[model samples]
Every structure is written in C-alpha cells, then in structure tokens.
Target chain A: MKRVGIKDVAREAGVSPTTVSLVLNGQSARIPDTTRDRVRRVATEIGYAPNSVARSLRTQRTHTIALISDRIATTPFAVEMVQAAQDVAREHGYLLLLVNTDGDHDVEREAVDALLSRQVDGMVYACMWSQVVDVPAGLPAGTVFLDGRPAGGGFPAVMPDDRAGAMAAVQELVDQGHTRIAYIDAGEEPVPIASRLRHEGYLEVLRRAGIEPDPSLRVEASITTAAGGVAAAGELLDRPPAQRPTAIFCFNDRVAMGAYRAARHRGLEIPTDLSVVGYDDQQFIAAELDPPLTTVALPHYEMGRWAMQVRLGVLAAPTENDGVHLMPCPLIRRESVAPPPAQHPAPAGDGE
Target chain B: MKRVGIKDVAREAGVSPTTVSLVLNGQSARIPDTTRDRVRRVATEIGYAPNSVARSLRTQRTHTIALISDRIATTPFAVEMVQAAQDVAREHGYLLLLVNTDGDHDVEREAVDALLSRQVDGMVYACMWSQVVDVPAGLPAGTVFLDGRPAGGGFPAVMPDDRAGAMAAVQELVDQGHTRIAYIDAGEEPVPIASRLRHEGYLEVLRRAGIEPDPSLRVEASITTAAGGVAAAGELLDRPPAQRPTAIFCFNDRVAMGAYRAARHRGLEIPTDLSVVGYDDQQFIAAELDPPLTTVALPHYEMGRWAMQVRLGVLAAPTENDGVHLMPCPLIRRESVAPPPAQHPAPAGDGE
Candidate 1:
C-alpha cells in the first residue's frame, strides 16, 4: 500500500494543507478548534505517520541532540563527558542540549517530557555516576542511555567496561612492585553496576596475585567530589607509616585530585612518598596538578557518538546480549606513580 | 465572555471531550476524517482557548526552564554562569536545559527551535562571553537573553556592568601604588559592548589619575583561554625586566590563570614578583590555584534567576528599559595581588 501523505488527509478532511501542517505539528494553539479537530481526525484515519524524517529533509534538523544528565555542571567527569559528547555531536552535524536534573525524579521526568516536546530526534541520558533510578514510562521514541545500563530491559547504552578497567588499574599497581595497595571507593552503596564491577575487578586481581584484600585498606565515601577523595585519603593516611599501603587506587580523577591535595597537606611527596592512580582522565584536572596524574581513559567521545547513533535507530540489539556494552578502559602512565619507597622496610608478615 | 472549556467545544461539535482533546492537543494522528472536520468546525465557531496554564494546573507545568549557552564546557566563566543559573532555576522549581552551540549561529538557531518545540515555559539564552549574534526571529513567545544584549532588541536581558567592572579591576590595581599597570583584553574585536565598556572603564580610571594610557600596555587576544592569556603574558614578559608593567589586569579569570602559570613558570612569585587581577571569579580555578586569585565576581545566579522570571512573565518590564539589566560586578579579594615589588624603581614613561 502507498504511504499516506498530509495532502491526502487534508483532501479527506476538506481543510487546507497549511491547516493540516499546523495541527499535525502541534501548533494548533493559533488555529481555530473546529479546523484542528477535522485535520487531526482525517490524518489519524488515513494512517499518517507524520513522516518526521521527511519533514526534517525539507527543513534541516537543528543538528542538535539532547543530553540529560542527573547533575552535570558540578561533576568534572560529567562536564568532560558533555564536552566530548558535544565535540562528537558537532563532528556529526549535531549540537548537544545539556540539561542538569539535580537527580530529582520529578525534574528528570519533566526534563524528558520537555525534550520530547522539543521533538528531539534522539536523546542521551547520561547519569552522574550511576544509581538505579526508575526510567519514566512513555519516553519519546528515540532515546539512549549513557554512563548507565537500562534498568528494566534492553535499550542502547554506552558505559565503560568497569570490571576490566578496575582490574587493569589494580594489576598495574601490582606490577609496579607494590604489594600493599589500597582502594578509595567514592560512591554510595548498593553501588552502580559499573562501580560494583570495578570493585569486583580489583578483588579478582588481588585474588589472582595471592594477596588478600584487607578491609582496612578499602575506604568508601558518599560523593565522588575531590573533597570526598581528600577525606578518603585522610582516612588512609591516618594509619601508622609502616601499616599504610604503599600505593592507592582512586575511583576517578576528581577523587585522585583530592587525594593529591590531601597527600600534599600531610607533607608527603607523590610517587616517592606515596604512589597514586586515578580513573576517567579529565584533561584540565590532569594537566593542572603539580605532578600530572596517572589515570584510566574511558572512551567518552566514542561512547557519546555511539549513543547518538543507537538512539537514531541505526543499531540492532546485540544478538549475544549481555545487556551491557563493555568498552575498553586504557591506562595512561604518568609521573604520579613509581616504585614503592625504598626506605621503609617490609612489615613483619610471613611471606607465605 | 465565559472561558470556553473542552466540554463546551465538545458539546458544540457533538463529539466526546476526548475527541476535542485529541484535536486541541494535536494528537490528530489517531482520529478519523469526517468527525475531525465536524468537531473542528464546531469548536472554532464557539471560539475555544485551550488555557495551557489550566492544563498545567491539572498536570503540573513541566516547571523546567532551558538555560542555553553558545558553548560552555570549555569556557570556565560560562561554566560558572551555568552553575549559577542552574542553582537559581532549581530554586524556582525549574530545571535548566543547557545547550552548547559552539558559537555557531546555525547551532543557536536549531537549539532555540528545539527548546521551543519542547514547550518550555521560559528560556535563558546565554552566550559564552559577549558577541554580536543575531537572535533568531520569531522566537516562541516567552524567551529572555542572558549575558548578551539582543541584536533586534525585544526580549529582556541581563549582563554585567562591564565598564564599571573593568574600572574596578583597574582602580584596585592602581590603588595598590602601581603607575605602570597594563591591561590584557581577550575577546572578539569591535569588542563586545561589555569589553568595550571595560576598556573605556580602564581608560577612564587611567585618565582620571593623570596617567597616560599606554597603547603598548593594552593587548587584545583572540579568545580568553589560558593559552591566549599565556601568549599575552609572553608578549608583556618579552620586554626587559625593568620595562615590564608592575601589575597586569586580565579580561577574565581564564586569562588570569594563564598569566599566573606563565609567571610561575618564569620563577616569579605572585604579588611579590608581579601583581595580577582577573574577572569573573571562577570558583574551581580560583580555589585550586596556589595563591588563590583575586578577581571581579559577576552576579551570575541573580542574573539567571531574574532572566527566567522575566521570561516567565512573573516580573513586569521596567519602564525606563535600556534593553539591558546591568548587575554590579564586585571585587573578590584573594591572594593573587599586592603592592608591586619594591626592588624595581617605577618607570617614567612618555606622556600620551
């Protein structure tokens, strides 16, 4: 059967094409009620799909995609992710519409509704460090999840391979001839899948190396801000020098920055005094620090591009669906980490 | 005349209230031709207004406002402005939708169109820095400009008192007992009204003090990034140590940070070796730097809140409207500036 067009609906309803266009586009506020009803009824009966793509061809798409994050402006990683996302979006004839929801469910609901109302061809829902938030029912058709896994089913999502990324960070610290390594976890619990996976990866690496994970060496903070990282660092540094871990692995760049500041405040030099490793290599933070940070680079730009493509309905659901796309998180070796301090003698624990 | 309700329209059209709603809301894709036409004609004959506010009362207004910036992720001042805007928007039960246009006119057009399509109750158009960009014609009613004066001038706008702000920076430097103070202006030329006012402010203070405004001391950089500031610093520093200005006043915070980096790289101590003042006191950059920066603070949050309230029709337009709301820019004193080094004697320059 031939596809129905606006002309056909207009002819059937005995309304002008302009009337149909106005009513169909939801600009019916300016139109008289009688005409709007007639046009809509005829369009519906004739099975008109509104042909948004066809409409877009005539009027160039704003070449912009909406990026809705829980609270992006304050989070450094989120800010960088948005920047990378905008870069990628611009490369593909699109701009980024970034909305900060402040993690309010009502706000999130309103944001989604507003984006839909704007007729965003696609959407990128980037949560700030994932937590299980209910995806509102009845979202605009083409939407993708970013930095988060779809909660109740399959949806196109882009997130780091947290398990592998965490393992790599831990493995690198182990390889640098450091046995006593501590983990500074910055996030609330029943941690996000990404966070949990990373934590598990750290444990897996420790287990494989025949080293027991010590509870005392693991520190958890509520927020992933630099201040939280500083607090975590304080907790780690309060232990006796001999009992302190030789190296530290931070949750992300911000936490690592905090750790750097904390170490300095305590009069300890980096690398020589205490080695540090961070994740999410944010350029500004990394470049500005006294000794540049060593970190794991999550493919933020690539993920953003892929998220848009997925929302545009270009990708089919993964056949071997694990419900997660685990992208590689590569390590960036910088001056922050080095061989453990030579002066301190090994603790009096059995080699076995 | 009584306000015509959906029921009244339905009664006139001899159709169900749902049918009138489908037509009025433009959900016409599901209705039939004959009935749609009859319903529309009857509704129009009765002159029905949908009363969006009443609809919102039944279903809460999205309560989301879009705070759109040309590009913010890379511009530190823009980022601070967005954060402030978000804070105020949230306080007003409104979420901020941030769009990065990358300073592209086409992108700005598209972003505005998208925001309008979303049915945002109000909008805040914030450009990164100030420039002469045409506001798209026929903006959906209820939009306000921020940090920029509208080109064709219909909307309410909020911008800093650039002349006053600039004068404050220069006056502060002068009062610290430095006759050889220089200015590094970074922005587009013909200069934004804000920059022009600032330059005027600088000259105003200089002329009042009987100090000849040296053309050599005023340098304009392409953009206000740290790199731009560093290059400007290099130009100033290339002069003989005795010839260099005692103090430098930067166009914005990023440029100041760059100057700070350059001075530190050249083994000069802040204030003691060289005094500096910046604009738009960005929090993160200011707090993290070694000697926290002293700069002018733009009232970003108040401006944003006021901008939104104007667009929301909550505030009446001022009678003596200058098309711009000039907020006071206050000095935030920190560790970055002090009296010039006592070792070097003050330079005797040629009169203008």
Candidate 2:
C-alpha cells in the first residue's frame, strides 16, 4: 500500500495542498476555522505526516536551540543547569540540543559548527570552569555564554556571585569567633573566575576585620575532588599543633567530604576539634556525611533557566559593559562548624 | 558588512556555485584534490558561510541524532548513556540532540514531533523505566528504543538480562546455605521489566532446589530508594524472629542502603545476623556503607557504549526473539554477608 501524502489530504478535504500545509503548520489564524478544521480532520484520518524539513526551509526558524557545555555530563552543577534550560525551552515550544566538548577548543569549535549546520536559532555556551580563551571565529551572532565571562566580549552571561557568597561564608565564621580561619582551595594555579573571586572574598573579609592573613594557612590542590581535599587537610594536620588554624574553608563540597574523611581518619571530631566549611551544597555529600556540612549553595538551576531565556530572546540581549549577572549564593548552615576550643591561643601576629 | 555568498566563492575560484557546493559538502571523491583545495581556500578567504538548511534540503541528511530520554539530567545511568551515545555520534561526525520528556506522553509526543521536524537522521529513545506505550506514528525508520521493549516489535534495543543476573544473585545466596532467603523488592507494582525478570529468576532458582516459594518472604514497595528499601526491610523484620529469613536480596543499591539502615536499627549484625545482596552497584551505596555492600555490578558504561553502537548502525540490529542483551552482573563480595548462625534452630514444618 502507498503512503498517504499531503495531496491526498487536500483532495479528500476538497482543498489545495498549500491550504492543508498552512492549516497544519498553525498559520491558520487568518484562515476560516471551518475550512481549517475540515482539512485537519481529513489529514488526521489519513495519517498525513507533514514534512518538517520542507516547512523549516520555507520559514528560516528551526524552533531549536543549541546548548554547548564543556563536559556537562560529569558535573553536578551542569546537570542542574541543563535541566533548568530544558524546562524553559519546553515552555517556549523549543527543543534544546546539548553538546559536551570535554573542554577541548577544537571540539568546541566543531560542536558550534555542527549546531549551526543544523540551523539552530541560537546557542548557549556553558563552560565547566571559567578560564580565559580566544573564542573561535565564525559562530552566528545569536550566542551567549553561561557562568563565564565571554571572550572577545559582546555575549551575555549568567554567573553566581562567588565573591559575595565566599565573603558570607567567612563572615559567618568570623561572627562565630574564628579569627585564624584557613582557606583550603582545591583548584590549580591561575585560578578560574569563581575560584579567584572566592579567594578574593576570603581576603576582603579578613581585611575588614583588621586581621592579617596568614600565608601558611592558605593551601591549594590540583583538583576539587575529595582526595584533593584530603591531601590539603593532611598538609594542615602535618603542621605543628600550635600552628594549625581552628577552622578550614573548602573550595567545594567534594573537597569538604575529603576533609571530613581525613579528620575522621585522624580521630578528630568534626566541629568540636576542627570546624570545616564547604562550598556548593551537593545533595549526596551534604545528606550522607556523618554530620551534615555547612556550605554555600550555588544557584545552578536558576542560571540554567536564565541561560535558556537569554538564548530564546525572552530576556534582553546583553550589552557591552553590562558586566556579569551575578546571582547571590546563600549559606545553608548545617552541623559542620562551631567556635574554637577555649584553651587554643590566637595567632601571635594578629594580636599586634 | 554584507555577507559573502556562494556566488562570490564561485567567482573567486573560477568555478560554478554547484561545483563549489559539491566540494564543500565532502562529495569530492570524484573531484581532483587541487580543485577542491582551491574552492575551499576561496570560500574561506571570502568568508562564505554555507547555508546548511539549503544543503540539508538537497541531501535530506541532517547528520544529527535525536537522543530522547526520560529525564537525562537526573538519572545517572541515563546521563552516562547519553554521554556514551554522544561520544559514538561524534566519532561518526553526527551530533546528538537531546530531549528530556519527563515520561509525560504529551511532552514525549511534542519532543518526537520536534525532532522529526528537525529531520534528525535517526533517534535513540531511552526511558528511565520500561512501560508499555504505542510507538508514535510518523517517525523515520531509524528510531530505536533503549531499555524499552519495542511496541509491536521490529525496533532494536539494548537491556540487561535481568532474569539471568537475578538468578546469579539467588544462586550465590543458596550456595551459602541460605535456604530461607527473603526477597525485599522495593519496586512499584506491575514491576519494571528488570524487577519482574529478576523476580522470575529468584522463583525459578528456589523451585529448582525443591524449595516451595513462600509469598511471606517476598515484599514489594513503591520505589528502590534507600528509604523505600528501609521500609521494605522493616516490614520483613516485623515477622517473629524465629520465622525471619537467614538472607535478604534487595532490588538495587539504594534499596540495599535502606536494608542496612533497617538492620542496624534492629540491632542485627550484617552477614552474621542477616546477609544482604543488592543489585545496580551505585558507588556511594557500595563504598560508603558501614560494612560495604555485596552487590551486582550493572555494566552502565558498557550499556551506554552498546546503545550508541546499535543506534549508529555500528552493531547488528537485535531481533524480537533475542529479547534482552543480558550483560553479566558479577557479584562484588564485600563484608555484607556471611553464613547463618549455627545455634539458631530451623523453623517448624519439616514433615516430608
């Protein structure tokens, strides 16, 4: 048996194929409702499938958006972001095509080209980490970056206020009587935007309190995994008991878990012996920890929604000098931190 | 600045636009390399961007695959499957366009229509759990389902051999002298294919050993979350101490965690008091559990790889009679189980 085509629907409905096409494509707003209904009913009865590719050719819009992330599958934040983006896209009758590049510039370039080839109306480029790089040339103008500063400028972005969030974490620690707090960063050299902002926030809070920063208390690790956090904790513990800080701030939750594990291994009671503060309230880490972690919550889902809105033209296009849209990160205080021991002495230089 | 057209490239390269189009589309097997190079260079220098929509119109190939999944962002296994599919697609110069339907039929229909409209070369349909659904009409022939048995047959699929894997778990328990094994299945009623198959395997193994199946020993719950598992375990433990089974088999790792919690709550020692075996060896549940769980490792990554290969036509299409591609679920023996206590007397009813 031969498949039914648009011509058969038009013939059955006593109309032209063009009329059937117009009605099926939802351009029937100007057409008579009776005629539209008749055509639609006939088409449905015959199972007349409209050719989408042909329709797309007639109208330049593909009703599709491309989301290019630098390895979104592995990152918790990226997962939330993608979910939010999908939610917004579905609401707007658009489909999201996600492409993960594994942070490779070449792959990024190829992905962009491929999305463009598919005629995606717009693009959202979300990097795993905010690192400076030259934007590849030849992309369509309707592109925006998510959680990163756009290279070569002009593109809009949505990012968390890392500095303010970090400042809040430290300020809370200070309010709780922590004078010699150590910032254990689980990120490599030439830190990414979030890391640098967080580090700066740590310093600013200390400066405001008139407390001189201790260089010995600052630590860095290669990655933000729990193992990296463990290594950093090991280094801190290796120092003389008199020199160790009362509390430690981790870069993220994974690092904090490692710190918790290391402290457990060393027979140090959490909060009672050494308070540990974490960033990014990842659920698995926070819920399963022996005593839940006190951490900063990054607005990943909101960022994703904003990213999609920006791409869909629902939000205003970013202008030059618009700077970053820094969403606030709130602190979720669980059972991880407490005041220092009464007998522990303050750092010697801070008293001066 | 005005956009450079294909005509401009043709003019610069002293060739027809059709010739230039053919060479740029990689249909240059018949054309000389020197001529192809000249056309490409001219196109690049003139900043001529090919109109991909027009190219697609001529070729009817999008070089894109639609990966329709039920909540790709939240389901860990689904995320890995999509990533593996993307990796495979990328190798073949195909882009993966993802759509998350959240298991809503309306959303699924919309996504299917949208992807179909985009003229995706093929489709990979992955669901969080298997259920019966009519295959949407008017789709291309290359669409395949993952983790779902094809409706009305003919579509290729990749799924675990739940029955065989379950039998292995049961056989292991039986070998350890667990005659009265409890099956705490924390899965919804009209159980998923995996659960049902595994249950069948469980029943088959017991019958073969000349043991009458006891319905009291089998309990079902709404889901496989740790909390659900805990609830199922609690119900099982409600039976008098004398009648409780010597061993327990959980639906998955999450459920197993709940079982561990339940056992701990009742002051029952793992393995010694109650031996437990789990399925789907999720990392956190296996590694972080107090005694570490003895669970079956599902080949998540390999399944992902196979799903991609099958969709891309790199692997042979499976037939309906082939049923599930049962991957081996080798038990990872941790400290979770041991032989039943020798002092405990067997329950009454031994008249043969």
Q: Which candidate is the best by DockQ?
A: 2
What is the C-alpha RMSD, rounded to one decimal, of candidate 1?
Answer: 10.8
lDDT of each: 0.73, 0.78
Q: Write the per-residue lDDT of candidate 1 for residues A192-216, one digit (tens) a residue.
A: 6766777898889999999988878
DockQ of 1: 0.18
TM-scores for the candidates: 0.65, 0.80
Model 1 per-residue lDDT tens digits across residues B102-195: 7777767776765554445667788766555577744654467778877777767787788898888889988888878888896674446767
In Å, residue A205's CA in model 1 sits off its true spot by 4.2
lDDT of 2 by residue, A161-273 (tens): 88999999998888888888888885664447778889999999999998899988889866777777788887886688778888888888877877886786687888998
Top-lDDT candidate index = 2
Clashing pairs in 2: B161-B326
